[model samples]
Target chain A: MGRALSLAVIFFLVLLPLGVGGSTLFQLPVFSQELVQELLWQSWLQSAFVSFTFTVGLILAVCYLSLWLGQRITAGLSSSRIAPLLAVPHAALAVGLMVLLSPSGWLVRLVHSLFELFPSPPAHWWIADKSLVTMAVVLVIKEVPFLLLMIAAQRDQLPIQRWQTQAQSMGYSVRRCWWLVVVPALLPRLKFPLFAIAIYTLSVVDIALMVGPNTPPLIAPRVHEASLRFSDLASLEAWLGQWLMIVLGAMLFVVVAINQTVYRRFGLDAIGRPNGHSAQRICSGFGSQLLLWLCGLAVLALIVQSVAGTWFYPALWPQQWSLGRWINEWPYAWPLLQNSLWLAVVSAAIGVAGALLVLERQRSQRKKALAWLPLLLLLIPQLPIVLGWQRALGQDAGWLWLLWSHAAFTFPYAYLVLHGAYISFPSRWLYQAQSLGHSPFNAWLHVLLPQLRGSVALAFAVGVAVSIAQYLPTLWLAGVSYPTVTTETVSLAAGGDWRMASVYALLQALIPVVLLVWASRQGNQQRWKSKHVRN
Target chain B: MLEIKHLTISKQQHVFLSVESLQVAGGSVLTLMGPSGSGKSTLLKWLLGEPLPDFQIAGELWLNGKQRDQLPIHARKIGLLHQQGDLFPHLRVLDNLLFALPRKDPRRHQAALEALEAMQLSDKANAWPHQLSGGEQARVALMRALLAQPEALLLDEPFSSLDTALRGTVREWVFAQLKQRDISVMLVTHDKEDAPGTIISMKELTHA
Candidate 1:
C-alpha cells in the first residue's frame, strides 16, 4: 500500500505536464491547428505563474481557513460535533453551495422578494462565473468541517487537556487557554488534514468545474474535459500529465515553501502565546447559535430549493413545494441512492475488515506499516489515482468492479476511523481473555468486538460518507450512467441550473446527513452512559 | 506455583522491568511496591508475555513445575486486574463476570449469578459497570477475574482509581477473595501503604 501510494504521489506530481505533453503528442489535426503556434516563452511562463500563484494562494488560504475555523468550532463545542460535520460529503456540499451562491439561487431569490422586485428571478451567473471566488468559498466551507473532525480525533491524544489545565492554572483565562494552549496543540495534528484540503483544492475537478470559472477552467477541469470529451487516450493522458505536474508543484510548495514558512514564522509555541488576533472572539452567545443556525439554514435552503416547484423570481417562498423531482427522478435517483448506500456499506465494511487484518497482521511484527496510508489517501486528491486507475483499466467494466474500485477510496476512510481504536485498545484485556483460555479468534470476536463497537460504527459511517461523496471516481469508474446521488449532483451542477442542481445536491447531502445525525447521537449516548448502554 | 526467573521487560524502547527472579507458592500473595516509574507494572506484563520492546527477558518462568515462559498468555491460566478494575465497560456487571466463563456451559448464567451473589454484587447483575460506585466496580473487577478460575493472578495498580477510604476496603476484599479462591497472586503498586502480604520492594537496577 505504501509503495502504491508513493507511486501515486509521484504520478500525480508529473500529471499536468505529462497530460499536456501527451495531448500535444496525440493532437488530432483539428486540435493541433487550434493549439497555440506561438506557445512562446512569455505566454507559457505567464500561464504557469498564474497557475502556480493560484494553486499556492489557494493552498495557503485553505490551510489557514481550515485551521482557524476548526479551532473555533472545537473550542465552542465538544469536538464530537466534528464527527457528524465531517461525515457531510464534500462534493455534495460543494454542489449545494453552487445552488446557494448563484445569483438566481435561493439567496438572491430571497433577496429579490424582500425588495419586491417580483416578476422574474434575476438572470445572473454569479456561480459558475468566470471568477474563482465561489469555487474558493465552496472549498473552504466543505473542508473546515472535515479539518475540525480530524483535529477532534487527535485532541484526546496530544496532551490537550494537560496543556489547557496548565494554562488555566497559570495567569491565563479559559479563553486564553484555548487560544494559547489548545490551538497550538491542535495545529500539528491538523497539518495532515490541512495538507489534504490543500491538495484537494489544487486538484479538485468536480467541484471546481461545477461552480468554478469556466473560460480557462481550473487545470483539473481542463484535464477532465480533455479526457471525457475525446476518445483520444493520448490527448487525455497528456492533459493528465499537465494536471499532475501543476498539482505536484503546488503540493511541494504546500509542504516545503508554504508550510515551512508558516512554521518558521509563527511556530507552534509562538501560536499559543498572546497573538493579538487571539483576543478577538468572532462568535458569542446568540451570535454563535445564530451562526450554527445559519449554516443549518443554508443546508435547509439547499434542500428546499432542490424540491421547490415554481420557485422563481420575486417570491420569498416557493409557489409550490412538491415531491415532483423526487418522484419524477425516482427511477434515476432510487437506484443511485441504493447504489450509493450499498457501495458505502460494502466498501466501508471491506475497508474496515481489511484494516483489522492488516493491523493484526502487523501486530506480531513491529513495523509501523505506513499507518498514514489511510489518512494520506484521504488527503491526496482522488483525480490522480482514480484517473490513473480508470485509464489503466478501460472504462467498460462491470458494476461490481466499479463498486470495488470505489471501495479503494472508501477503505482508507474506514481504516482511519478504526485504526486509532485498534491501536489504543488495552493489551491487558486480550491477555486476560487469553489467560482465561479464550482462543485468539474467540478473544477478538467475544471480547474485542464489543469493546470496538463504537469505533466500528464510526468507521462504517466514515466509509459510507466517503463512498457517497465520491464524484470523479464514481463518474469515471462507473461511467456516470449508474447515476448515484453524487454522480447526479455533479452532473446537474455541471449543467449550471442552480434549482435542479440544488435539488440533486440536497439528495446527495440528505443520505449522509441522515446517517451522520444517527451516528453522532449514538456516539453521544455512548459517551454519556455506559459501555453496556452503548451495546 | 508461579515463578519468575530473570524476567526483563521494556516499553517504547525503555527498559522497564528487569526483575532477576521471584517465586510465589500456590495460594500465596506477593505484593510488589515501588515508586512511580519503577517498572512494577512492567513485571506484570512480562509474566503475561506482553512485555514492552525494551525488555530483554533472559530467564525462565515456571508455573506448576512447567516452564510457562514459552506458553501463550491464555494457556498460562493467569488473570489480571488494573486500577479501574478494568471491568468490561460495555457489559452489565453480571454479564462482565459471565464473560470469563466458557460460552458452551449450559449452566453459565446460573454460575455467573452465583458468583455475583458470592461477591454481594447480585443487585448489580443488570447494572452497568459505570453505574456502580468505585468500591462496587472494584469488587466486580476482582470477581470477574476470579470467574475465569485462573490458577494464578496478577494486578497492576488496581486500586489507584479508588479513593483512599475505598481503596483499603477494596484491597482487603481483593486479598480476601484471593485467599478464598486459593489463587496464587502477584500485585504491583506505586504506594507502599497499598502493598499486600509478603511485600517485595523493587530495587535499583545495575548492569552486573
Candidate 2:
C-alpha cells in the first residue's frame, strides 16, 4: 500500500506540470509565435525589476541573514519563536505590512506625533510608489520566518556539534565556523527553499494586490487581472506570463545548481573560509529583535483594526473601539469557520498521509531528484497552478475539486516537515524492533509509529495551516461557495474594509497559531507518559 | 547449537566478510574480533536476516538443527544487542521487556516482571531509557534480549559504550545470563577480555 501510494506520488510529481500545461494549452487558443514572443518580451521588460532582480536579492539576503540567525539561536528555540509568523498568510501579511509602512500608515503617524516630523508629501505616497525597496522590505519580512523554518529543518540534518568542536579547537571562532563550515554544508539543502522564496516573492498576486503599483502592477497581479477579464488575447498572454514565471523560477534553480556543480567539481564542496568575526554582531542582534517587535506590532495592528469602530490617519490609536465588527460578521463568519475547519482537517489527513508515503519511499531509495521533488512542487508558485486548474475544471468544480487542489498544494508543505522529522529519526529504532520477537509489521505498529506520532501530528498541523492559508486556489476552484478565512480576508481587504479584513485576518492567523501550538505540543511530547498518577 | 556454513557478504561488486564454518554449542559464546570496516556489524545484519541490497550473501544458518538461511529478521528468533543499548525510548523499563515476549504467551507480564526482577532493577519498571544510567540501560537491554526466548543471540560491541570500570561487570553478567538459558551466543567485540570460550577472528575468514 505504501509503495503504491509512493509510486503514485512520484508519477504525480513528475507528470503534473506537463499534464496541466498541456491541458491548459488545449483549453486556451494558441497564438502565433511572433505575437506571443513580442508580448512575452514586453512583459519581461516591464516585470524584470520586481519579479527577477529584486526577488533574487531579497531571497539571498534573507537566506544569509537567516543562516546567521540560526547559528546564534538553537533550532528548537527559533522554530517555536517564528512559528506564529509562519501562519500569517502572504496576502494577510502584506495587508499588515501596508498598515505599517504606507505613507499615512502607523510608522509615519507615530513619527508625526513624536518627533514633529512629516514627509513633504502625504504619508500614503509610497504605498503605490513602484519602489522595489518598499516591496522588498515587505517580502523580506514575510520570507524570513519561512527561511528560519527551513534553516531549522536543515540544522537537524547536519553534524554541527562535531563541526563546531573541530573548528573551535583549530582556533576559529564559533561564528566563523558557522559561516565557513556550516554555511557550505547547509547550501545544498537550502537550495530548494531559497527557490521557493524567490518564486513567491517574484510572483505573488494577492499580496501584490494589497501593495500594488496599480499603474503597472507586478507580472503576477497583471496576469491575474488580465486572465479574469477573459479575452482570447489576454488569456493567451496571461498563460504566456505564467509560463514566463515558471522560466524565471527555473533560472533560479539553474543558478543554484550551477553553483553547486562548479563548487563540487573543483573540490570546493567542503571548502573552508578564513576565520573572522563580522562588525555586524551588534547590528544582527538589533535587526533580529526589531524584526520580531515589528511583527508583534503588525499583529497588534490587525487586532486594533478588527475592533476599531472608526479611524483616520495620524492617530496612532483607533478613534473608537467596539466588538461591532466581530458581532456583525459573526453570522457569515460561523459558516466560514466551519468550512475552514473541515476543509483543513480532511485535507491535512490526506496530505500528511500521502507525504509520509512519499517520504518513506525516499528514505530507502538513494535518488536525490526524488527527494527534491516535493521541494520543486513547493517552489512552483500557486498562480500558475490555479490558472491551469481553472482551465481544466471550468465553472462547475465543487468540493472534491476544492479538496484536491488544496491537498495537492498542502501535501508538499507537509512533506517538507515530515521528511525532516523522519530523516532525523534514528534508524536503529526499526532495526532494534525487528531484532526483537516482533514481526516486521508489528515492529512498525508497536514501536516506530508510537515514536513518530508527534511528527505525524506536526505534519498534519502544517497541512491544516497550509490549507487554511489558501486564497487564490480556493477562490478559483470553489468560488465563494467555500469561504475560508483566507479568502474572506482577501475579499474584505479588496473592498478596502480594514476593519473587517482585520477581523478575518486575525481569525485566519489565529486558526493556524492554535493548530501550530497543538502540533508542537503533540510533536514534542515523549512517548512514555508521566509515571506519577493523580492520587 | 547454532551453525554457519560458508557465509559470504559483499557490497558493490566487492566482498567484505566471509566465514567458511563456525559453530556455537548451547551455553557457550564465540567472540569474533575484527577491526572497524571489517564487517563486524554486517555479520550481525546477515545473522538477523537483513543484509543490504548492495551486499551479496550466500550461506546456510542453522539454529538447533533447523536449516534457516532465508527468513525475515523477526522470524529468525535471533536476539541482537547493539553498542547503543537501543531500548524503546517510548516504552518503560518493564514494557520494553514485555514488548519482546510474544503476544499469545500466557505469562507475558509475569515473564517481563521476572526478567526485570532477575536484573535487580524492578524499582525501574516505569523508568524511561533516557532516565536510566548507562549500566542500567545495558543490563535492561541484556534482560530484554534474553526474555525474547531466542535460540541464539548476536551481540555487536554491546559493552563498548559502557564505562571501563562497569564494562567487565556487565560483560560477565551478560555471559552468565546467556549460559543460564543455554542460549548460543556470537559476541563481537575488539576487547580480548570479552572472549568467553572461543575467539573467531573475522579477518581470518574472508573471501570478499
For each predicted model, how many residue pairs clash, with residues at least 3 apart or on different chains? 31, 6
**Reference-based TM-score of each model:** 0.86, 0.90
Where in model 1 is the C-alpha error above 4 Å?
A1-52, A71-80, A115-130, A231-237, A240-261, A267-279, A282-295, A358-370, A376-380, A419-421, A530-535, B6-21, B191-193, B204-208
Give lDDT tens digits, candidate 1, residues A1-535. Answer: 7578657855653353134344454545534433533331324344445545666667666555544554455422533455545555666666555556556556666666577563554555545443577776666556656655665556544666677678777867555676555655555545555666656666677777676776545666656766666655446443444555445645544563457446546755675576444334563333334434435666777777767888655566788988887778777677777887787778777877877776665554554323655555555555665666676556755577677777776676666555555665666677667766787887888777766666676767777787787777777767645658787777776776666666666666776677666666655655554433222
- Report lDDT per candidate: 0.66, 0.74
Task: Give the per-residue lDDT digits (tens) of candidate 2, residues A247-343.
Answer: 7878877865664455446534343455355655666667767777777788887887777766676677888989988898899888888888888
TM-score of chain A of 2: 0.87
> What is the docking quality class of candidate 2?
acceptable
Best by DockQ: 1
DockQ, cand. 2: 0.44
